[model samples]
Target: MSIGRTDLNLLKVFEAVYEEHNLLLAGKRLHLTQSAVSHALRRLRELVGDELFMRTGKGMVPTGRATAMAPALRDALRRIEDSLGVEPFSPDSSRRRFVIAANDHVTAVIVAPLSRDLQQAAPGIDLVIRPSTRLDLAEQIDLGRIDLAIGIFSQIPPRLNSRTLMSQGESILMRKGHPAARRKLTLRDLTKYPLVTLSVGGQEEGAVGGFIVERGLARQSEMFDRRALEEALRESKQEPRSRVTVPHSLAIPALLRDTQMLAIVPASLAVALAKSGDLVRRAPPYKAGTETLRAVWHGRDAHDAGHAWLLERVAAAARAAEEALG
Candidate 1:
């Protein structure tokens, strides 16, 4: 296949169809008819000597060849658009949709406030949240499906770029009127009361250096530093009665609403969750060092105006969240 003989428009159609997964929608996006989109796809497939895509009831599924072509193709298109001067992004006037990846806690702590801020400043913009803990997170970012990922990412691939949001230590959260709510959280208290914590993954799932491995990508899974907590426990010679471990941080409020179960969570998240006035936050006796919250995205989008604008807003939100934590 000669690259020079291929129609560049087919690549555009491919990108739109790959993203929308429907020829009609892709055609509408490209301002072409359904038949025209089909024709271009066929020509491109024949030239490249690959089926490229397969039609399914759900939509058009890209073949392995197309999947392999997509990330680089989209990146090239972004570069081309940037070189040709893409339209200026006006959040207030533009109806752009930003897909951000965040964990449930970050969504509540940071993204929730961001939505309210957007309501007044960029009313026309839309936000889509993706779970940052998903196995294919990096792949999704590379495919341009997720514009930004907000969380504690300790290992960022070379292809990706990251910006730190805030650094936070662990805090103990317990319901009001709890046995320990009246006093500072101590290792002895952790040993006495049944503890609840969040764990996305553990050593069984191949975590090293406080990160969990999934789909070849290492992500910070354990919300707090286990080694530090264990070290503190050993130094104090206390065995914590850790009973309930949950996957979602949002469940902590209900879990601790009336019971004596205490949770060790990120201070920033503790601040957000404590807004209900039922949860009390206190410094833990153990020395769990600070964890940096960050936003990660494909390096290709680092310079895109819209993405840059979203980054600015997310940074501001992080700042606001940090301030609120204090």
Candidate 2:
């Protein structure tokens, strides 16, 4: 097992394949043809005397050996790049593509502004947004497929770094002319009016407390504090009733339009949707706790020029969105 016997370039191919899980995609990432990628993978398999990856219907599934070697190898490659120094990132000319993970709520509230800023500042750069609510979100970030993730995460693994983008509380949304729209939201209204709430996953999906944990990362499962809501309901001697339970924030406006159903959602999202003039945002009667939106990324990208630029742009967009709520 001499280092001299192995072509270092082949390791890059392996890294791309491990991150992408598709030979064609790996080839695209490295600017190589699909056949060339296959050849490099074959050479590496022979050099290591093990089948590092197996072609399957879903994608190239990595073997146990490949999984065990991934973290260290990826970190070593990043270190090598750092030592050699990468070209300075020029936002005006670079054609680099950045992949971000976020739910529809963040996409509407934060990423929409970020996209507009990128259009003017870096026209050639491509942006791709994936759903952060996916169960494999942690794995995707760890594998380098997603450059950044924007969401409310309770626990982040030590290998990843996170920063708060904004903090928001729950707000009740209703149609403009609804019967209760003119008054402040109260506990009696909670039991009187039918409600609509957001829940991405529930106890059936292994959600504990109010979060769903995967790969040592915890994301909020329930957007609002269920305990606080229930306690307020108990004081009224009534039970909370949800007329509609939806998984997406974008669907709230439609679900409440021309209906009596009231929706409880993040204040930022409520403000964004209410701009259409059909909906209105109100503070909840109870002290609904606030949640902080955060941007999370791998430690390997901490010093990368392109990543830092994108992060700054995202933070600016978040700040703008937060200010609008005031």
Candidate 3:
């Protein structure tokens, strides 16, 4: 179907219906009467040559065809809206909520400061922090469900625009007054203690494990393999040493305090904890893989004023974090 011939309003009705899953709620969201919504749906059904949606006990359920077209329709509307500049960007006036995908590690290391700056600079802006995962990032951005994604993404889709925010390595952390804190940590010292490692983006072995392998202190292994190592260490030693696994980098400090455990975490996190005097940070004995945190968005948002504002703020925040760590 030709783009110009299609009724754009129909897509809006479809999107509201799909999201609300109830014609009444969808009509309310669109500021339309139930009859008007039904008329729009009927037109859409005729154009698409399908029922589009069916009334169910749960709500209005989209047909498979309608579900498939939703993302593209959403993208089309977003592109048109952005091109027309329908919503003029005024940080102080615009009260639009932006959803950002990032993990707690990124939040602890960066967003705290970024959010503070945003509050002072753009009081009308609302921000939602969502979990950062590899699933559907590009698709979500395209559909305008997520405005930006920050952190290390293993893969980048061709249609997205991205800029590297910062590069970092990992560090080893131990609690104050712990036996391992008295001496510079070697691989043997690390192996002797139970470990608490941060798992970011499913990478558990992380930089310290890579560094250990690079230094010939240990063999290269996956995070699962490292977990096995921890299990063997626990079973082989007469005294049971405890090993704990956590997801966020910020949690490492609390986990290490008054415990004989050590953690490998992002350098930014380690530095933050060290400045607080709650933990001591040391370099890993071997070379671990480095990570490049990047800010990514859809190409359609490349020239959007609000999106541009967000990018500038994020880049500024990244620089501030790097300088503070330095």
- Best candidate (score: lDDT): 2
lDDT tens readout by residue for model 1, 118-222: 999899888989888777787898788888988887677788888999888889999989988887777888888988888876677676776875544567888
Cα lDDT tens digits, model 2, 127-218, are 99999888888988887778999988999999899999999888999999998989887788888889999888888878899788988889
- Candidate 2 versus the native: TM-score? 0.88
TM-score of 3: 0.71
TM-score of 1: 0.90
Clashing pairs in 3: 211-286, 211-287
Stretch of 10 with least lDDT, candidate 1: 209-218
Question: Lowest-lDDT window of 10 residues in candidate 3?
Answer: 214-223
The segments of candidate 3 whose C-alpha lies over 4 angstroms from its true place after superposition are 1-66, 134-139, 200-242
All candidates: TM-score: 0.90, 0.88, 0.71
lDDT of 1: 0.85
Stretches of candidate 1 off by over 4 Å are 2-7, 24-36, 213-217
Residues 52-162, candidate 3, lDDT per residue (tens digit)? 999999999889898788777767777888778786788876665677888777787778788898888898777878876434445556656678888765456667778
The candidate with the higher lDDT, 1 or 3, is: 1
Candidate that beats the other on TM-score, 1 or 2, i.e. the better one: 1
